[model samples]
Target: MDQSMASDLIGDLISCGNIDHAMVDGNKRPFICLELEDVSGNKLRNITLWSDYAQQLNDALGDRQNLGHVVIILQFMKHKIYKRKPAVSSMFGVTKLFINADIPDTHTFTKLLIENRGSEGDDHHVTHLTTFSSYSIKNDFLNNLQKVTINDIRDIVKPMSCVVVATVKKIEREADWWYLACVKCNHAAKQESVSEKDEYGVVVKKRSIFRCTNK
Candidate 1:
């Protein structure tokens, strides 16, 4: 409610999703979502950057390969419910963000990272996995690997060969939704349903389903 009452969160960037477009107030706007981890206490928080903040952060870090390694000091942050989930967000006109600074909290974070992970030269920036799909596919082979939080994987580059720990926020899925396969190859059969019986035993026809053209 007030600046003095807001909380200050210091952590390292763990996962940074792609900048996405959203319709806000009848206009298109940019927004970026990120996950941060507090190294001192091993806490995780979801962050949402909207409007100007989103644009600015994207422009600054978009080209950077190490999005996960950046240290973040969020001042005057407030906890609120967003996107049907709880998150900590920047307080407009009140919150200030510090990036990779030598502040006390940041120092503690760096020290912990170096001690636990050991410095790897200048490539110590956070390794960002752009999509969870990619991460899951690439990391499926790892067994008995140490679980590190998103913040802890700052040095993990793409095609993640090493296992890092992170909290799973939401697992998106659909019931009975799958790729249609080719009837001949049996490789995810695709079919164009000409007609189907409805619950009332009436025939109904719909648009063609997506199917492999080669089949």
Candidate 2:
């Protein structure tokens, strides 16, 4: 079947990755990425869940990883390109998800997956699970924990992590959207002149930057 025409997916979910963020209306929103094999094909297809749906998948997957590969049935979902690759996403109110559900479709697909599946060494993406909870950021930041607004930040007396929805009226500095950071420590690094170089006639200063070894 054509990729776009295939709305329902059933197979062994390779892995569920971290819950990521995307910018929406100047606010940060959460999303999740997944990979799974479909009954019709041997290769794994990329899947994504956005907003509350991502939280729902996290909710439904509590302690299930100990059971091995999960057979997921995504019904009424939509296919789209995420980060320039073929992937699927949930359709808000329209989509329904079944995680290792005890149903006929799940059983049939499970058998096919077990029979035709090969070594998982070829699967490219290895995702880290952030947490396993059915908590939606839209409903609250943490499970039963409310999100704070920009105006609510000043009244705090103790240090705590917070989730907020705010617009970027202006950046503190121009061209500060991207920066270089140490991959190991994740600390921002600055550039400096290391040595002076004599090219042919004019002298040039060589700049060194952000090569943090945590030494």
Q: Which 10 consecutive residues of model 1 have the lowest summed lDDT?
A: 126-135
Q: What is the C-alpha RMSD of each candidate to the true structure, in Å?
A: 17.6, 16.1
| Clashing pairs for predicted structure model 2, backbone only | 59-134
User: What TM-score does prediction 1 earn?
Assistant: 0.49
Residue 113, candidate 1: C-alpha displacement in angstroms: 2.6
lDDT of 2 by residue, 1-215 (tens): 24565487766665676677877689887888777767566655567788888887777767544546577788887877654778777876888888878899988877776666653334433345443233355445455776567777879887677767567797677556787778776656666557665767555766665565434
Q: In lDDT terms, which candidate is top?
A: 2
Reference-based lDDT, each prediction: 0.66, 0.68
Off by over 4 Å in 2: 1-6, 39-41, 63-65, 117-215
Segments in model 1 whose C-alpha atoms lie over 4 Å from true places = 1-5, 40-43, 66-68, 120-215
Q: What tens digits encode model 1's per-residue C-alpha lDDT throughout 1-215?
A: 34246787777676667777767679886767777766554756567666666666667676777444677777777777654666776666777777777778888778887676666325645445353233464465565356776666676665446644457797668666567767665456455666677999888866667576655
Per-model clash counts, in order, read: 13, 1
Total clashes for model 2:
1
Tell me the deviation in Å of residue 5 in model 2.
Answer: 5.8
Instruction: State the local distance difference test value for candidate 2.
Output: 0.68
